[model samples]
Target: MALGVWSPSLIDVVLFVIAAVVVWKLERRRRRGWATGRLPPGSEGLPVVGETLQLIAAYKSENPEPFIDERVRRHGRLFTTHVFGERTVFSADPEFNRMVLGAEDRTVEGSYPSSLSTLLGTHSLVVMKGARHKRMHSLTLARLTSPTAIREAKLLLHIDRLVRRTLDSWASSSLVLLLDEAKKITFELTVKQLVSYDQRKWIESLRREYLLLINGFFSIPFPSFLSFTTYGRALKARRKVEEALKEVIRKRKLEKATTRFDVDVNESQNNKKKKDMLEELLEGEAEGMTDEAVVDFLLSLLVAGYETTSTIMTLAVKFLTDHPRALAQLREEQEGIRKKKKDEEAALDWDEYKSMPFTQCVINETLRVVNIIGGVFRRAKTELHFKGYTIPMGCKVFLSFRAVHLDNEYFDDARTFDPWRWQKNAAAQQVGGPTVYTPFGGGSRLCPGYELARVVISVFLHYLVTRFNWEEAEKDRLVFFPTTRTLKSYPINVRRREEEEGA
Candidate 1:
């Protein structure tokens, strides 16, 4: 309390030094706490790098989550690891998932479909937040939902015709690869239903671009190395889509711009009717973007909407083959539907689809187990405080549930695939719920097409099971193919029933 000239006792100087040290340590803790945790419970790892290398190594063959399992079991649910000069959380906890997704996610900075952002503009749907997300999703639902009546009619006939065509050809080879066949069928149908009026060749070109753009995401971001495969290919494919979309958009603009009818020009329903999502997005402010931006959105949707579904289908079959009893049960259920009269031919109306408890369990179980991608991501939006720890904003957050679902606490015999664990009245397993079971992710901003995926997947499975008989060729040998290049895919073989019956 004395003036500047006054001297302090030796004890006062010692107290000042201790106070300074304490303050420094507290600041350091705040900085450290803001980053996401990389190490999940149980496992041994050195600082900074943790188990990243092990994860990539696991992707080389069967059972990638084991390393993750080792860590989670040893460490417990929450632990830390540093990577690329940052800390991250890799969680499988339902509560943690709920915090990230369902809780308005203001803790997270932003999310995107990731792979789509590099190919499309950053402002595209994958990168949108708040108002933009709501608007775009609404518009997209309108477009996708508009033709539901038409799509439903298309589904029954399209499914039957597709199965028969594929099965009819199955005799050439006793074994059929359901993986490839299902993708092609879905791709063709997705294009037909979604593209609606585009010319076949043009739609094909767009589809090709979508696949290319997707690959760009997983690449090392090394432009010099992959200019030809990733960078150059994305640009060329993007240009093709831009050309086709721009032409249509321009024609529509001219038609709308001029009141007088051009007698020679044939008009599209899209032009006469109110704008579809694509058209609406093209016209909407969408942050003052241009025609190329709109094309990017369409291409991205096809990639996420189509490709993810295809991956799920592949995993579903692989799971079904692994558990024959479950597979048999599914087919038996389908057989009952197959016996229905033509007028009552078992179709899943919205109610029936939602009511399929067993099928819902199958989907959740599949999502819980499938390692379609190695990571889930979000960036911190603001400095968030949890458990007396502060995480600085703009840091990335990830939950690699590969190990969590297999965590014994979450599942009793976690390695085994069991849909019954989720069934009502079961003794009880730790449910991952929406967050930890998040293949579609959590939050209001969760993937809009998830419901659409369930419908498409359920219908596809129903058709495949009831109408065709098939078996795995190298059931055990096949594994999910991992490329440093892109999304996970698998190859499996099957035998067609119709041909066996004919024999």
Candidate 2:
């Protein structure tokens, strides 16, 4: 090495050291400002990136527990880690999480990553707060869950057709990736149910763009340069989806007006007039809701309606395949229901869906095991104290349901896949209090689509277990970060029931 010349490696080491020093100083200054109260113990990590890389790495790993486990060992159940560019108090303590969840909008309110708010839109339901949030939530729920809105025979037929077509598509293939296929089913279902839009026409391009938009939700808050960076691509994808949805909204409005003039209200009401979420929103718009709110509502519903439900449905297959006894029980339950039905092709009605107690147990078990929604994010509305630690006003808090659901204290033998645990008098069934094992979240901010998601999963599972049998082609390489999913999309070999019986 030359004595007077600096090598590239030397320059890199020098920069790293300088960066470390700067980060340490900034963290210390920030801590000093919060020294008035006892804050939760944990690291904020390096400057800019903070603990995000570590958090993301854990999520990508097959075993994500170590990330929270190691932290809990160091800082107890209630600790702090900076994730998604915010200093967050991550609570694995079930009691504390419940308090925070119940205190929504009092001491804390919903907060999400900047990328999510940006991609979802400024008026997204997930980010909306106060009176506006309440109004949107009420209207959205009424439209989604109303008795009249839910009984649309056309919508049920569409779901049946889509599910069957998806299964048929996979029948010829030797290997099927559940996540990929599940996404197809969910995306199409949400599109039809929410907007009455036939996705087959634009599904390929739209799915690609939608994925780009999703990736942006996890990307670093980097400035988009020439629409080339991850963030830039996300922004572009959002614009494309927004435009497409806007066009659909416009067309629907015109159609609604045309229909209004074509038929009398009494005549139309007398008929089985099918109404989707868009139609309900159009009605609301006529009552004075803004177009922007309608678009945001549609976009938010696409995510809420599809992503988590699809993830859970895919995981149900994985878990069922791994546990044959449970699979057999589920098959028996589903088969019994099928045999009792006069029409084999008839879709599961709301009452029929409600009758499947064992199936609901399976769904609950899958939700607990998969923990698709890692936690809920809320910002402290005022200075708050929990377990003798202070969370200064505006500090971000993440209620870690994953930790709680998996904790042995809350769920005996929690790591195992045991749907039977949800059965009456089962140990696991007795363990949950009001908020323990809250996979759907809790309080006012709990997912309003919870019931709808449950029904969707149940319907898919009913058709799946009765119509087909699946075996994993390879061991699942499950990823837990950002969300719980498969590294390779969880490929499996599926066979139709008739083919399997013949073989």
Candidate 3:
């Protein structure tokens, strides 16, 4: 970098070479230390500008998992990469996953691309680590996820109405734009889940803006200036949505509006008490959860809910379209559930929802096959030694599913789509636990809406599978999600088939 000693052309090459040497030295150090204890194996890849952009670009086609698989193939299980000068490791061992993603590891919780943090902002539980992070989780659990609230959430009229409207509009289309559908559903669901209906327009605008910012993460390369600009616009769009959300909170806290409280209430009363997720956020007993905190909280719920549910839905429909037999089988099973003894229908609440083991299996398998995030992230709380290698305390780590799901040792016929595998062949074992098959991530920071997601998917999918026919659009367009994979527009052929739809 010194001007007198080196010309710019020479400087670029010199700096790169030095970076390569540093990576080689660290890798050798890690590999040599492994004799003292066991360690996972992988590569840091080539050094370039203190980052792995080149490596990622070169390998992104069959990227993420392929990189992990290739590295694991060459380096074994646990391995280190010094790309960007970070001694990062991509480990597949379940125990290692436990060390990084499981609870009690705070040091490695918050190290990610700044763009990621920028996208998540302060409201996200994903980026924050330690007591504050855990506290945020607790605050979420305290009010929004309480048992009674879950039951009441089902009765939310706005959500029910929105879902009905959304579905009704889909009747004419041969192929529904899956991603758009999911965004609409997620935005409506989040608003329905987190805030009031008065701000539906703002919430919608926010969803669009977030989508743009989120899209920039993967489709666009970094430096993030463009993303920041998109984010700035999104911030403006977000302001409109936030205004509506904050207004509800302001109204709730200032007015102490108990008028909206009531079980099995008619529409009039529900409107007055603020029956949205925003209201529940307002109702939290946390000592100092600010309005901005509440706003961030609501925004995260929207993004998380939208990204996961929408992508999964797109994949499920796509998979089912490819595997017609499975689709037919699932339809039969759903029909059977409907024709069950009256007692069974009565029992088919949340408990019965879980009872649909086959349905759950399909969802689980789908997530395993198409995990949206390449891996789960964490940072070292302090310098730690696993096996024998010293992971300089504060080294960021990830337990990638890209490698784990495909590992032949763990999943038999891992590449095949057998929805019944979890129910029949693999029924004895659980797919996701503390460390393995972690699509929603793991530990105290595990996705809070996992259950809600399952429920909505189950119900929404139950309706789709039971009542309509589905097929891929004639042309399959690639959807470019910045940090996520969702359909840009999946035009699936659909048609309603009976008295259930009230023809």
Candidate 4:
């Protein structure tokens, strides 16, 4: 070896190689628990990558259930697998799922991929924890379900008007992508409820940005600065969404401040303005919540209200279309309500909306079959034990609602699109019990907008069945990866029922 620039000798090279191997082994063991028999039975797959590729691949295929089903067969309902750069426990058992969800903030906390957390922001309700999460969650639920909100006749009238207008536009269309139309209705409804903004151009543009943001939820989390990457584009979209929301908040605050005492008392009494969600949050129960928190909170609601509800609407229509008997029955029920109305233009009331037992059954069946949310990701806050298996602290736990919902053990003919099942089974009527049915999720994190979602979908279905007849424009299939949506947006050719009757 040269004095100034010495090359490694054989012993030194051997020792370095040995150290590298040891470190790699330790990392592998740490991730997979190679030395412990306590972790659930399963394989971690290839190091670093783990089963993420397989998971993604399976989800992209026509049937995504096999990924869990196959694993469950081999490793039982609760199994260990490394996915999304972490050691995760996938639970297919309804009892265990209930326990995990019930354990929120105590033993487990909300967890998601880095991509989702980044897009949703630290202040988002989905990622929020402890008292902060509890406060916001309660506030959101109260506002959404309050007497002045969804339960009000005015709000129900608004929803009916929006659904009617949307379907009216689709009446003359040669081709309609049901999913896109559903999104338009839901986005407008959510925006109106949130900020009282209903301008077509602004809602459309913001919805486009939201679509991009959603695309990145299941994408690679790092290297987000690269403009071309899906995650990168999603981040950009999120920023735009945040800025747009902030501007809305700014304008709203300004307007409120400017008009605080300037209104004529008589005029104000004659014309009472309904408070939107933004207004509610501004004067929120959760004290001292910042603008950023408000933005993130509203963004989360937008995602839930717009994407998930729209998807449900589309899937409900598709399922109804496929099962003609169910469709005929649903149409009859909706038409019965329509006949009782004063006139064709009269809007549905809260009582009428709640009166649709068959509609609720249809919505429940759609949620069960489609499993729009699929499951949730929860991180174990401490070492946990369940049914003799030990879950190490910090392990990601996936409560597979899809697995539970579709299990033949819980639901008879689980794969069938049977709305009548709800009518027969008493337990199925309760939508979020966690043990058997959890379409809107379970425990503390159950969706606040579940009832609202039902209302929106029910109203849409009422108008759709009463006014229009539609058939598929082309065959399309459901894709579950990233999100559950139709490959072709479920295009359909629709005709007004009056026109059809006249013909």
Candidate 5:
């Protein structure tokens, strides 16, 4: 009986060894195929986690480009690495990036990791493609960029009032963290524009939730029920946002439904038509869009709108303070506009806004140097061949905006923050022809809120430069990983322009 039992155990062990050998051979063959044939050069790191940690670290580093820079040195511009649980192709080639963006569905598709997709929701404009994307883009573009929309929006006046309130509150304080203050300003403006809500009541709560969600976007995905976990907290934040928005949407729908049969056009109690972006979207729903789609679109708008504008605004101040000449030129332009006004309180109209060419140049320079969106993510719909290498089917592609923006080949002394570079043909050429300067991305996927962001930044710069003078409170620091922000909230000392003049 002992002999028989030992023999059976030996047989089981032999079978297990045979199975292991088979798996080993198959994996070896697969790796050989990847190396000898189509896939680009690079290590994917260990399985499951891949190179995620390294990529995250790079983003968090002071010089964020080294992540791609080091890899490009080893494996050329287009190389493969595993990121976010999938094999990804990182292309720092500007021409290639422009081509892929222009190609759209013809060569690849818009894709994000499941974590991001889940957070953004199914109906987000980020995920929409082809005909659906075009339709949504058109709808959004009409409302966001059209001359009529800009004229009717009166964004500058509202932004000015909001900025005044913010500065007034900070006047008593000697030091102000500009990045933190800028976030509050942008968030308030975005909320007001999107839904016409009174932001004073909701801004703090929404800001808290949005912080959680943004962090979770780049955090490693882990299954957890505890709110302390990144994904769990993100989910909780999403729920809060959804609940708050659901009520607003419901109320708007009620208003729309209640006014359907009125012979004369129904209006608010003040006898005026609703003018917010939400009102425009609800009208679309009346024409057959879903409630979830509207909510997702609105949330995506918030994601696109607030942080980027705030970061750039903070950077603008930083760069201006460092370069006194640029600051003087900026002030000259804005001051000229101010002189055109009847008084400091006079509203900035569309004409006045468009006339500030120098201010626009400063905005562009800030976008370039800061590289707010370091890259754009796309996935191969099929095998893609470029520059004599093959990008395999379904691989993720990172169009490195940072690489293109800072490349010496594209810009003379690209590292410098010279807004005047934009005033010349150098910067404009980047946008023309091959389209290298993609601060807002390119093709049909271009950010619908680009013009809106421009308006917001310009207005903020106008008020800040013309009203208050500020200087760095200490040797300020910044980080670019996950996203661009100050090492410390970017504190600075502020004094009124009048006080500066008197002193």
Candidate 6:
């Protein structure tokens, strides 16, 4: 038939459709090849979904390393895969991970999954960029690390009192869920440090909402208006938390204003207490930051200071329990400190807190082995060349701290819980460089509360070893998906040291 004025046969129509499909596929492949240039070697798995399902499944299991280990065997340390709805390169190489973290805002920028970005809010530090990130990060770091903050006498006393009170409550109970209890201790401390609000009922209510918000971070992001999904529930919980925080901010502002005109004697005495982070943010250190921004920032800090730090503390206890020799050594060190104090009931001073060397080893080992924060996500801003391979612009990169931390090449029996390994000078460098052991992340994005975490954990350990004895009440296993945590919240049977001595 003449193409300009003829009817086509069914076979001819079929042939034409086939040809078009072929052309379209070829064009798509050609565009992808050109856009990505030379990517690392790995599979993109199923279309659209990619290997995300596989990643999630592996994470859900007790061991998540197989996902990366299998890939590393086939594709070496650096490989490519599609996950979280984007083509990404997974880097287990220490040098590459270091470069990626250090290159923030230059060649790459901090990124997270759509769910995380939405739940954490647009103004959260993890989603900030350029000068705004630098300013907020610097301000947060300074305030948290300052002598007037963690190291202050009042704050140190507060932390010690809080830790002691928490442990005291546990003395009456024979069985305790360590992870849940640890969360309570850290949550109250964080709330106190942030807003100076420690009403037990209010904090318990806020924490319930916070947990819902956190669970949504790793969920499939469906439109909240469309369905009642985990992410949707998370969005709702976030609103409740934000409203609670905003009310706190409003009262704080009103108090600040009222104090200027009329001050009762008790009010003046109360005002003499040291300023919290919220007070600093409200009084102009974070000038021009909106109420929403302030709330988001505090929300992020709560995640950092509360969830992660509590997990670390719980795991540290777990690790030490699994290795009694380490626990004994740690107890001896802490006891030595206790002997020097004039009053055994007195709070630990800054020097005493800093003096626990072996305790630091336990914390480091826990961080390395458990890797509560398995990895971080960043987006490439420009073509990034590393080790003769080109990372195309706009590609998501995952710096697998878990892979690096668990790799035998980096540490001797890297997966083992050996606190003694950190005994050498330049402990992190004993096996590899500092980049290889980034439990709290690294570079400019390093956790601002790192010191505070160490201090809090150290304080808890001192009281725990010196005051009480505990044993696992039941067997529990670790789960790595969404986040790393114990299956049973690490239940333990406790006995106060005094009762044991009296018996």
Worst 10 residues of 5 by lDDT: 263-272
- Give one digit per residue, the lDDT tens place, for model 5 in 17-73: 786577556645655655634776888886545788898787777776777788988
> TM-scores for all candidates?
0.74, 0.88, 0.79, 0.91, 0.88, 0.90
lDDT tens digits, residues 354-453, model 2? 7898888888888888887878889999998887899998788988899988888877798998888789543434222465778878877777777767
Model 3: residue 443 alpha-carbon error in angstroms: 1.2
Give each prediction's root-mean-square deviation over alpha carbons: 11.8, 4.5, 6.4, 5.6, 6.3, 7.5
Candidate 6 local lDDT, 1-503, one digit each (tens): 37645554565578767865776566457447646477888998876567999999998887878999999999999999978767789989989998888888999998888889888888887888899888888877777655556665377888899999999898678999999999999999989888999899999999999999999988977668734788889999999999999999989889878975565555565556447789878776557878888999899888888888888899899888989999999999999999999999989999998899899889888888888778889988998898779987778899998898899988889889998888973443432235478887887888777778888899999999999899999988887878764454999999988889999
Model 3 over residues 45-77: C-alpha lDDT tens digits?
544333367445534343344555667778767
Poorest lDDT segment (10 consecutive residues) of candidate 2:
424-433
Sorted by TM-score (best first), the order is: 4, 6, 2, 5, 3, 1
The lDDT for every candidate, in the order shown, is 0.57, 0.79, 0.63, 0.85, 0.79, 0.85
Model 3 TM-score?
Answer: 0.79
Tens-digit lDDT string for candidate 4 (326-390)? 99999999899989888868888888987899988899989998998799999888888888998
The TM-score of predicted model 6 comes to 0.90
Q: Whose TM-score is greatest here?
A: 4
Candidate that beats the other on lDDT, 3 or 5, i.e. the better one: 5
Q: Candidate 1 at residue 128, lDDT? A: 65
* Residue 369 in model 2: lDDT: 83
**Model 3: ten consecutive residues of lowest lDDT:** 218-227
Q: Model 2, stretches more than 4 Å misplaced? A: 1-30, 146-149, 152-158, 260-274, 285-290, 425-433
